[model samples]
Every structure is written in C-alpha cells, then in structure tokens.
Target: MNFVYEKMMGGKKGLTGFLILATLILVIFPLFLDIFRLNLVGKYLTYAFPAVSLVLLWGYGGILSLGQGVFFGLGGYGMAMFLKLEASSVENTKIQSTPGIPDFMDWNQLTSLPWFWEPFNSLTLTILAILILPAAFAYIIGAAMFKRRVGGVYFAIITQVIAVILTILIVGQQGYTGGINGITDLRTLNGWDITTDSAKYIFYFINVALLLGVILLSRLILTSKFGSLLLAIRDKEDRVRFSGYDVSNFKIFIFCFSALISSIGGAMFTLQVGFMSPSFVGIVPSIEMVIFAAVGGRMSLIGAVYGTLLINFGKTAFSESFPELWLFLMGGLFISVVMFFPNGLAGLWDDYGHYITDRFSKSKKTKEDSPEIVEKKSDESAA
Candidate 1:
C-alpha cells in the first residue's frame, strides 16, 4: 500500500513539474520571439506531436508503426476537405468546385460531381471524420493484426504497403484527389481566413500547445502500471502470455492510441500549412517518421522531442542559408550522428551527462592524489 501510494505521489509530482515547465515555456514563448522564430517553434511543435506518439507506441509499447503517415494524412486531408468546402459557394452546395479541383475535374473529362467528395463538403462531418476514419482503420487493423499474433516486420511491411497503395490510389484519382498534387490551395479553415499573419501566429501557438499536451499525455501513460505491462509484452511477449497476460489486447490499445495522436498531428499540419499532399504520406514519409523516433532514442520521450527539434532545426537552417546544398548538409549531419552515436542523439544526452559525472569523479580522485595538480587537469578536460 505504501509503495503504491509513494508511486502515485511521485507520478503526480513529476506530471505537475512537467506541466508547469511546459506551460512556462509556452506562455513566455511569444514574449522572447520575433514572428519568424515563433513560426519555427510552432512548426517544431507540430512535428513533435507524432514524435510523442511514436515514442509511446514504438518506445514504450515496442510497436514500430510505419504507417503513422496514414493517420496523419487522414487528419490533414479531412481538415483540408472541410476548409476547402468552407471556401466554396453554398448556393451551388453540390460540387461548387475548387480552383485546384474543378479545373482538374474538367481536364480529366469528368462532367458530374464525384460521390465520395460530397461528405467532405460539410465541416462537422469532416471534423468527425478527421478523428474517426484514422481511428477506425487503426482499430480494424489492430484487431486483425494483434488477434493473429502478427507483429514486428510483418506488421511493418503491411503498414508500409498500405502507405504506398494509398499514395498511388490518391495519385490515380486525379479528378477526385487532385492527383499528384494531393490536396492544396486551401484558402481558409473553420471560419477564419488563414491568410492573415496574426492567424498564422495563433495557429502556430495552437499547434505547439497541442504538441505539449501529447507529450504530457504520453508521459502519464508511461509512468503508469500500464506502461510496465507494455514493456513486458515488448521484451518477452511469450513469457507474458505464459504468465496469463493478454499481449494482444495491450498491443491493440497502444496502436489505436498512437493512431489517434498521428491523426491529430495531421489535422494541425493541414491547418498550419494549408496543404495535404501524398508526398507527406508516402512510403518514404512513413519510413521518415520511424527514423525520427529511432533517432530520438526510442526508449526516451525527451529523446523523441530532442531528436525532432534537432532534425527540423537543421533542415530549416540549412535550407534557408544554403539552399543549394541543404540536402547534402542534412545527410552528412545525420550520418555523423548515426556513425558515432549508434543509439542516437538521445543516447548522446545520456552519455554526455555520464561523461560529465565521470569526469568530476575522476577529478576528485586525482585531487586526493595531488590536490594542486588536479585543478589544472580538471579544467583542461572540462574544456
């Protein structure tokens, strides 16, 4: 009883600290920033949303999901569809048409409205679909895959194939989906005109706050006993099964939750950028999401956030300052980390703190051996 009580107390304290610090940063975030910096942080937060989810599903639950982009796309495309419809003429009400769409539909030689496109014309339905479609897909997929004991690479491949197929299908349905262009030319979202600079800033803050919420939520789940069961299932599912625990149920739970997180990220993404392209949800993008969480040291939540910030920051800086060679520059950066630091940037953080502590401990030893000389050596090493 005492152990449980103490654990609960610790959990509450930790969660409180996290919320306080996160709130502090966000509240003061706008004060110390130019619009450009604010916008960048917002973009970072948007990316961080999925990073949080991946850290849970892959990091804590030991489920490597490559089809995260599918959920992301669902949210994005769902929101985009709503925003597009909101911009259309209500008098026509049925296929009022978009600049990107009506023209393409005309070009594709389709005279009448597409049936599937009708539901997207309503904002409430789109918002509901934004949350529902991805989750429903996740549930079905999770149910089938988990119940059959399908996991690891087979699950990974199945997800990857889904992403590839979805992208191809979107491309093939040019008139309906805008083809290779995917979904862009979004003029507004909700009732607000997304064109104003202030609107952009507000949107950025909204994304950041949402990202922070996800981080806190994931942390809560990890600190709970549920997290313990997840890790057990990951490391030794058969043993867990022998112990009378249902591994499949836990796996599905995590998968579905992660899908919801990805969906939210996608929704924020479309709101901020006003674009939802197949490129953002293709096989490569799916793999990139995995690489992101992997680079963050899949075991650590802080690692996920750190890795995301590092990668996105590097991309932004290199692209802006050295447009011609940014790709090479970013590739070199990742390679350096992967080669020298096998566990990733998160591993580096742990190793770095360990190095510092070791240094101090060694210095203390040397100080006892030769008090005067130890200071010089310590100073040199610290530098």
Candidate 2:
C-alpha cells in the first residue's frame, strides 16, 4: 500500500522530494513578498479555507454540499454578534443589546428579546456556537442522506435546493436575519483595535496561519485510511458497504468536518471584514466557492487554495483596471480553465517536475558521454 506511483521507465519515484521542494518555495515566498500582497493573499486565504472543505467533501467524499455557505454564515454571524454588541448604543449595558437583529425587529413590534439570539451577545459563547452550529446541522443532514445511500446529482440538487430555501427564509425573517439589507457598517471586534493597521495585519496573519494549518490537516487525513474509505465510498458506495464499512458514518464525518472548517473560515472572514449579511451566505456565493475548488483541481487541496487566491487576485486586478469587463472577464477565466486544464493550476507543478527531471537526465548523459573531453578541457584551462 505504498503511495508511490510506478514510473514509466522503471521503479517508482518518490513524492517526498517534490513535497520538500514545494515546502521550501512556500516558506521563502512570504519572506520576500510585499506585505500588501500578503494582506490581499490573506483575504483570499480565508475564502480558500472553505474551498479546501469543498475539495475533501465534494472531490473525495462525493458530497456536493451547496449549503457550505450556511456553515460559513454561522461563523460570520457568530463574530458579527460580538462586534454588534461591542458597537451597542449604550455603554456597559447590563441587558445585552441584540446584534445582527434587523432594525425591523423594532418595526415588527418586538419589545423584548428572542431566547435563541441571547448567547450571541457574549463573545465566548458566540465563537463556540459558530463552530458548533454548522457542524451539528451538517451531521444531521449527512447522517440522514448517506444512511439512505444517496449519491450523485440528487445529493447536489438537494443541497442546492436547501441553500435556496435557507436564503429565502433568512430574507423573509427580517426580524432576525436582517432581511435584504443584511448587517453592515460594523466597527469593533472583541475589544481589539480593528482600525489600526498593525491590528489588521495581526488578524491577517492569523488567517494565513489557519489556512496553512487546514491544508496540512487535510493532507494528513487524505493520506490516512479514513481518506481511503472516503474515496471508496465516493466511487462505489455499495462496494464499500459490501466491504463491511459503515459508509454512512464516513460520509457524515467528512461532511461535519467540512462544515467545521467552513465555519472557521466564515467567522474569520467576518472578524476581518467587520460585517455579515444574508447575501454573503446566500446561494450565489455558495456556488462560487464550489467553482473555486473545481477550477483549482478537485483532487488537489493546494489547488483549491491557489485557485481561490488567483481568482481573487484577478478580481482585484480586473475590478480596478477595467471595471466594466469584470464579470465577462471572470466568466471567461473559468471557461478557459475548465476547457483547457482539467487538473487546473496544479498541473503546472507536475509539468515543471517532469521538465526538471528531463533536463537533469540529459545533462547527466552528456557528462557521462563526454567525460574525457570535459576532463581534458578542465585540465587545459587549469594549465
């Protein structure tokens, strides 16, 4: 069960050498790169975090969860709750002012509080809830669906439909979810001085660290037996069951893990951006997240992150230069990637590895063939 893929010419080639080389490049780039670019990259990294989950659950586990945005929304709203409370109309208020509550809550004649939203006013409680809420929902849904052997487009369709329903429900419930306008224009976070550039960079660095941590954690899982079971269930659910594995359990586990990761990403996103709204966790953004993984390379976790970062880079670039062409430009970019590169940007690494190997081989052969000539020339030069 070695991971080595057999070489075309002879024995297997090692994956370790490639990984080490990649690690060196990653470590060095940040040291020399511009801080502004790193900050921009930091923003994209949070988005990529959820895309990593998309790769694992959709790319490997065969679960096309269109509701990943909901988990993200949970985290964003969680942080927003704390930020809103910190931005309360009155200072040191004993009665926690409800945050993220639509202004219509007063219009709807809500004189008192909703029991469910009470914990949101507490920073500690909100953060914990942000992590838990999405995970619990995903676990329930995954348990129900996978146990029944649901797979393919049906699962995808159901998830998408659920996303649409949730978005509409949030919109309709103007009292709680902030309706259409969505929560915006927030100022403080956990009493941290968000206005300061140094403080912002601290948050940015935290996101970068988290993004790398998630990738490493994903690699560990993907190289484990659990990952193998996930792929097996993805490719052939019935076969996995026939092999005596509880396929449902594996699917639920991955689904929940995806939710948890997505929640963290969502929370950090709001924590940094200082706002949350129904539109963010809505259907379109959810679909965009899926595209990020698909275009990046469904099977590669790093591809997902790189794809997201590159896309966001293009967005910033395009939006700044030719604002009118932004939509068409982005669309064309996705179309090009989809049509031309099935393995996405990660294929560049594979191509470069082969190129380097070929060049090294040719150089070694030249040295072997011309050893006498080389040595004679060297001696002559020395003399």
Candidate 3:
C-alpha cells in the first residue's frame, strides 16, 4: 500500500511530470507557436479543465455526471453576462430603445435588465458566481442523488437531462440568454480591448497559469487521505461506509469541486473565445468532454490537458482537410481509446515506458557483471 501511494504521489516521477507540463504550457508553446495557433491552443486548453475534473470524479470516485456541460455553460454565461453588459453600455447600444440593456433585450421588446443579470454588473460578484453558482447546482444534484444511493448510470442519466433542460431554457429565452447565437459582439473587458493580438497573448498566459494552479490543487487532493477514501469508495463503497466514512459527502464534494473547475474553464473560454452559447450547454459537447478525459487517461490529471490538445488538434486538422470525415474520425478515436487503450495514452506510456526502462537496466547490469564473472572463473581455473 505504501509503495502504491508513493508511486501515485509526487515523488521523482511526479516532479518530472510537472516539469514537462510546465515547460510545454509556459515555455515551448508560447515560444514556438504563432499568435493565432497559440490562441487556438488556449481555447483547447480551456476544455482541459473539465477533462481533469472528470479524471477526479470518474477515475477516482467512480461518479460519472454527464452534464458537465451545464456547469461549463453556466460558468461561461456568468462571465458572458458581465462582458455582454459591459459591451452593451449606453454608448455601445445608443440605437436601442433601452440603451443600457443587452441588445437582445431591446430586440425582444424589453425595457430594462433582468433581476438576475443585475448582480453581474459587479465584477467581483460575477467572478464569485462563476465558481459558486455551478458548485451550488452540483451540490443540489449530488446531494439528492448520492444521499439516495442513486449512482452509476442513473446519476449520469439525470445529469444528461439537466444538460438538455439548460440548453432548452437558454435557446427558448432568446431575449435574456442570447438565444441560439449566444452572447457575442463582446469587444472589451474592464475597458481593455480583448480583441487585439496583445490581449489574446495576455489572456493565454493567464489561462495557462490558472490551469497549472488547478493541476497542483488536484495533485494535492489525490495525494491526501481524502484521495484514498475516494479510491476506496470507487472500489468498495460498502467497505468504506462500514468503516465510518460519509461516502455521500465525498461524492457531493467531488462533484461540486469538478463543477467549480469546469466553470473556471468556461469563464476563461468566454474571455479567450469571446462568446458563450447553448452549443456548449448540451449533451453532445458534454459527452465529448468526457471523451477528452478518457482519451487523456482518466487516472492522470496532466494527461487530460495533453489529451484535449491532441484531440482538438486532430479535429482542426481533419475538419479543415476533410470536413465530412471529422466526425467519423472522432468517433473512431473514441472507440479505439475505449477498446484498446482503456487507461488512455498515459497508461500506454506507463506500460511500455516502464518495460523499456527495465530492459535497459537489466542489460546495463549484465554488462557490469560480465567482468566480475570472468574474473571469478579465471581464479577457479587457477585453483
């Protein structure tokens, strides 16, 4: 048990992993990739948040909530609300009958902002809502489900339903939620134009920094006693429960934590991508996000980021060259990952990598022992 824990925790191997991740996100990509490609990578990196969170929930805790998109959308919409409000300032919306409100509101024949959007006017509150709202929603769902012992596929189905309901609500309420198009035409954030190349670069670094912070936090959790409990719950819920741990509380906490992480990504996506739409708040995107986690290795948090980047990169390349084949390729990739590499790219690396390392060590030792063995044989012959 100690050996397993040491291997999983931040020993030499973990430090090497962290260093590789840091070098890629902080140094290599920024130095080599162009501004356009870098920004695109930034967008892909945003998806990594949910992927990493899914690793914690599914790989460790065995709780698969398929409605992560709902939380992601909620977080994006929270930030989008603030940015949209700023963009719809009196000067920007002078042509509208209700100049200060969102243009969508004016188009829908509304005169003022809704009660809910009023709170987003404050930046601090918007930030808080980005984290709090999704966690709160997750808490409600998780509490209800886990407390009732309704888990596995049932919890997944309920979460999917929640995602569908959110998409419908956003699309149905065009005036308030920006409808099918989502909140667009966002130019500036806090009076600084975010549409410029310089701002994109700034936001990219900010996104990378936040991602690293999340990775570190997740590492802390996985190395702690709580992480052990989560693993126990995933493997043997009955045993843990009999051991006196509130398994439901851990589930709720992890679910909410995953929601909060995903929301932060969504908020960053709005800032970098400059839009928030119902397209992301649906079942399809949520499932794809899970694929991202699965492809990365549900057990490896850093692998989640690489998995998202690789998948998105493949998507862009395929969609550009063979638009019709993109979906087929993606479906095939998902199927292959599940069928062949259930633990993902990370698992493959751990398997073959350790094997190769062991072989090399054995060869080196044999070489070193050859001289000593020959010397011993020479002495016996002399005797």
Sorted on lDDT, best first, the list reads 3, 1, 2
- Which has the higher lDDT value, candidate number 2 or candidate number 3? 3
Please tell me which predicted candidate would have the highest lDDT against the true structure. 3
On residues 36-108, what C-alpha lDDT tens digit does candidate 3 reach at each position?
9999999999999999999999989999879999988999999999999999989989998889999889999
TM-score of each: 0.80, 0.81, 0.90
Local distance difference test values of all predictions, in order: 0.76, 0.75, 0.90
Per-residue alpha-carbon lDDT of model 1 for 1-383, expressed as tens digits? 65433443234333343444476447776788787677666666666667778888988787888888888888888887777656544442345343323445656776665777688877888878887888889999999999999999899889888888999988998877778987666777666778677987888777877776676567667768898999888888899999998889898888888888888888888887777888878877677677677777787665667677788878889999999999999888888878887787668756565565566678878777795677777988999
User: So what's the TM-score on candidate 2?
Assistant: 0.81
- Score candidate 3 by TM-score against the native: 0.90
**lDDT per residue (tens digit) for residues 269-308 in model 2:** 8867767788778788789899889888888787787788
Write the candidate numbers in order of decreasing TM-score.
3, 2, 1
RMSD values for the candidates in order, in angstroms, are 8.6, 6.4, 6.0
User: Which window of 10 residues has the lowest lDDT sum in candidate 3?
Assistant: 3-12
> Residue 114's C-alpha lDDT in candidate 2?
72
Best by TM-score: 3
